[model samples]
Target: MNPQALSPRAKRRRRLQQRQTVIYGLLIAGLAVAAAFAYLVFSGTVPSPWTRPITMPEKIETSETMECPPEGAYSVAFGSVKANVFNSSNQQGIAVSVAGTLREYGVTVAEVGNWPKFLRTDGQLQAGKAGIVAAYTLQQVFPTMQVMIDDREDASVDVILGHTYGEQSLIKSGDFPAGVEIVPPAECVPEEEPTEDELNDGGEDLVPEDEETEAPSDGEEDAEA
Candidate 1:
């Protein structure tokens, strides 16, 4: 018997099988599409820092360190509160951005100066102090920047951010964008108030009483006699 001339029942069964195959394929394709849609919706609707690709940190870590005077530097610490930011030197100590928007991400070092072994804690870079090494890219938002402390108080912070065009003696080139500036901390001293005596003396002459009297005593001697 010719295969093309199959029995009616055989042809009908073959058609049913083909229809079932197409239906199953369509079902599988639909399921894949739905899964992809669900993933995008969940990941997009939820706000997360991980959403933005951290390209620099993912590639390699870059860093640099410098010694700077707290004065002429930007304030990283205002009173008891510290701005957000951190830094590291070698395997010890972490630095911080003294005063700026970046302060929101400053570092708090549990260790004194051992950066690699230091511990960083803050709400911004919750990745821990280890994120210092991970911050390989410095995007410039300020025309000038500085990291400074309020006093000689130790644990003032390990690093500061500022521009160098001023009297700043330090310059951080690598790991920083070209022409990126590092400003020194500004002076933080309470304004001096004039004392009561000082205020009263403002317009007064400083002539001695004896000098003001001139030679009156010598002339008065004759009147008394």
Candidate 2:
């Protein structure tokens, strides 16, 4: 078709058709780009533009510190060490039974009673400044027991039995075993805070959607009115 042979109205219609086709193509390309962006966001392949960058704290180096007895601090004999037995279990007379067992091991029973709160583990040996050696000695007697440092100024150690307290001691002995070494106390390390993604991965819904209320019947509405 030659331009000279075409009418003015026909040329105008052809130009309008070309413009419409170009606009439709542009719309389709924009839709395709939008769909790709949405896919990336929903699939977690790329972070959303609205999200802020996270800055983690730098790691701090901690040196190992020790708290030990003074030089020439004599180790007291187990027979001379006094301990208080507290029952945190439901079993009756458990404190007395444990105290008797301690006596058999040559440890003096200072007191036998119930603890203020129940323990979570098998047992715990609460030691003070002067009772560190005594606590380790008790740990030697019960290998699975936990040692906790407390604020008492004296040498007395508190033995609290938990729910898993068995009637008999795991280690059988007439006298305190030799060659038991005491471990010096160390400072605790702080735990790191969780990241944003880690906190969001819990999968728990904090707020639930409210259910829609059913519409009242005409008769019921009229009666209420």
Q: Pick the candidate with the highest lDDT.
A: 2
Model 1 scores what on Cα lDDT? 0.35
Over 4 Å off, model 2? 1-76, 167-169, 183-225
Off by over 4 Å in 1: 1-3, 45-225
The local distance difference test score of each candidate is 0.35, 0.69
Residues 130-185 of candidate 1 have per-residue lDDT tens digits of 22112211212222332222223223233322122222322332233232233322
TM-score of model 2 (CA atoms): 0.47
RMSD of each: 17.3, 33.7
Models 1 onward score TM values of: 0.20, 0.47
Distance from true location, Cα of 40 in model 1, Å: 1.0
